[model samples]
Target: MAKSVAPGRPNQFLRNLNSKIACIPMMLTALVIFLGGTVWTVIYSFTNSKLLPRATFVGFDQYERLWAASRWIISIQNLAIYGVLCLIFSLLIGFVLAALMDQKIRFENTFRTIFLYPFALSFIVTGLVWQWVLNPEYGVQGVVRSLGWESFTFDPLYTPEIVIYGILIAGLWQGTGLVMCLMLAGLRGIDEDIWKAARVDGIPMWKTYIFIVIPMMRPVFITTLVLIASGIVKLYDLVVAQTSGGPGNASEVPAKYVYDYMFQAQNLGQGFAASTMMLLTVAIIVVPWAYLEFGGRKRV
Candidate 1:
């Protein structure tokens, strides 16, 4: 009888010795920096550490104060408004623009470049440019007044009711291009045979897109959704440059609140609590989506 070889020692992690060695530094960096800092913040969030971190645990007092603040409440409301509107409009405009570009039109590259050029600029730059453009005396209002439309009041930034919408417009201008690029890439990945089949079945273009093409592009849509959602959450710089949460804090966002309480107000515990709440919110939204997308048994 042939002697059976012991399963080659079961292939240790050291088998890929060079690759594992290369990844050691990065793995340690992530664990030490990201994980360690997160843990530290979460621990301190339970304390009343003002101006600096301390071990004086207060058990939800900071969180209660955070919720009671009007500015923080306004910030959450603003974030919710901006987040919802941003996701809807960005996806709609981006997909529409992508579909148009996918129509084999002439100068497609030129159009794509023109559309995507805004994304290359930083958000601060975009916000400042829009700030000027939305200025009542020197921007769209002025130009329209110059052309003799005297009563056309379109100053969203100055109006307490619509200042957030003004910021939303600027955000869309800066971000929709990236979304379009992503959607266009997804569109390009569609198999030509699928289109042929759709045509052969006498399906209208809109129906084909709604029923089949979009479902096939689920990965791309999910990627775009995450990008937009993250941008919505971290919307501090643009609001700062554009309106500074002005018009009586109509455009205040949670990130700005975190910054103000942390650094400007010297209330570290409150800021930490707010940041922890933000993290919890993100987890609440992401965990369910992740489980639905990655978990679940297949039907027989």
Candidate 2:
């Protein structure tokens, strides 16, 4: 027999009874629709579903075919190349632009708007506009040729080797502005006391930025990283509107591969497998890094 035990802390969940009851529908939708749909996609990925999702459990048969496909291989390679370069260049350009903008320059508002204007356009619009500009017929290559350079050959969309870089250029143009804005906000949030302390110590300005300012703005950097990573993973519309995996599938990305398999190829199993692999990629590759970077209670 046990003595009478004291009750534990009151359930905060019970305190919000009215709100919780109101949120039941939302909770049900989240559980049954979103979570259920995700579970369905993952479970069915193991089956050899075709035009319609057939419940023929094939135990990794779809995954085996997905890995063996040349298109998937090319897509992965392209994603790797595109992800790495995009991260480096976008961060570099954004930070540099943000630093320059922080100099308290005149007409700062005008300059910032000019820089960020491209970000206002959707990826589809951006891709189409760039497609025409990059085209050799009426684009830069043709325009340059008209200026007495008959051998001008700047056709990136058609060049299999460098087509990925071509897409990278457009991506950077449209994306770096947001990064710059984020970095600028971070930089501004740096306390004046820090700068004064650095000045009193006769620290070099660049060294102050590197050693003090950057470390202090860890949250901003993390936010920008998430944004850029999301853009990299969802990189379909731009590729579709711009290159369409042309020049022999040189710039085919994973999203496009998944879409093609699901919709065009009519292989739901293969598409589901590819998509599930994407989720795994984000989980295995990105999730850990993010957790390590920003997950802990410790602040920079």
Candidate 3:
């Protein structure tokens, strides 16, 4: 019987090969699309392309021109300021709201719903409403004057020096809700025994939250920060709706600048360059944060 045994068929090897072969079409499609788009963008960025793309290469001249443009420079500066202010304000307000909501007070669900519902609304609508509210002649300014506080002038949307802050205020209105939801989720996941132990040791509630609870929610905090940072990097809608980057481009941001050049100014090369710059900036900041979050975890 042993002498009569025949060679086994290569069933396992054939099956493995067949499985890999089945994935080839989809994998090729993805690779082709990704590489094709990237190559197109790179090629266009080297040319003096217009509204429609062109093939005449003009080297880095567009980039030089973009750097020299005052509006572009102002836009970059405004974005930096707005990014920092929005990030800090949203985090602080959201954290405070979450902490308050965690106190097991009356109508807890109602309070959470009220805080979170703002995030569901469109930023365009939110920006428009804020714009009306901040208008000088008929908004907060008028109301304040009528109430006998004639010195109350809240016209940052029209003030060149303080317009960026107005845009930040609108962004915060939409952004803080997201932060609140995230922080609330983190707070809810904390162990109740931690609170009991803290109370047993006579640890103050605020101290417990600031030191112990916050430290435990590091991952959530990092996640919220990253989310907020990405939003800051691509900030456009609220600024456009609320201020239109105006009162002399005081509220302009990088995304809006890129958009204007790409379409209105018919300077695709410069727009792509700005887009590339934004990508680089995001990579520079996000890579390290992501590495610490993910790579640090793997090492641990």
Q: Can you give the TM-score per candidate against the true fold? A: 0.94, 0.92, 0.88
| Location of the lowest summed lDDT over 10 successive residues in candidate 2 | 1-10
Pairs that collide, model 3: none
lDDT of 3 by residue, 1-300 (tens): 444444674454456897789999888888788667766777788898889888889988887887898988998899889888888889999999999988889999888888888788887888998999899988989899999998988899989999988888888888898899999999999999999999999999999999899999998998999899888997888888898889887888889989999999898998988877777778898789778878898878
True-structure lDDT of candidate 1: 0.93
Question: Model 3 has how many clashing residue pairs?
Answer: 0
lDDT of 2 by residue, 1-300 (tens): 123333675566577899999999999999999889889999999998888998999998889999999989999999999999999999999999999999999999998998899999999898999899999999999999999999989989999999998899899999999899999999999999999999999999999989999999989998999899889998999999999998888999999998998999999999999999988888897877967766864765
Mark the regions of model 2 whose C-alpha exceeds 4 Å error after superposition.
1-8, 18-29, 293-295, 298-300
Worst 10 residues of 1 by lDDT: 1-10
- Backbone clash numbers for all candidates listed: 0, 0, 0
| Higher-ranked by lDDT: 1 or 3 | 1
- Alpha-carbon local distance difference test for all models: 0.93, 0.92, 0.87
Ranking by lDDT: 1, 2, 3
Which residue pairs clash within candidate 1?
A: none
List, residue by residue over 141-208, the lDDT tens digit for candidate 1. Answer: 99999999989888999998889999999999999999999999999999999999999999999999
Q: Cα lDDT of model 2 overall? A: 0.92
Query: Which segments of candidate 3 are over 4 A away from where they belong?
Result: 1-39
For candidate 3, the 10 contiguous residues with the lowest summed lDDT are 1-10
State each model's C-alpha RMSD to the native: 3.5, 2.8, 5.4
TM-score of 3: 0.88
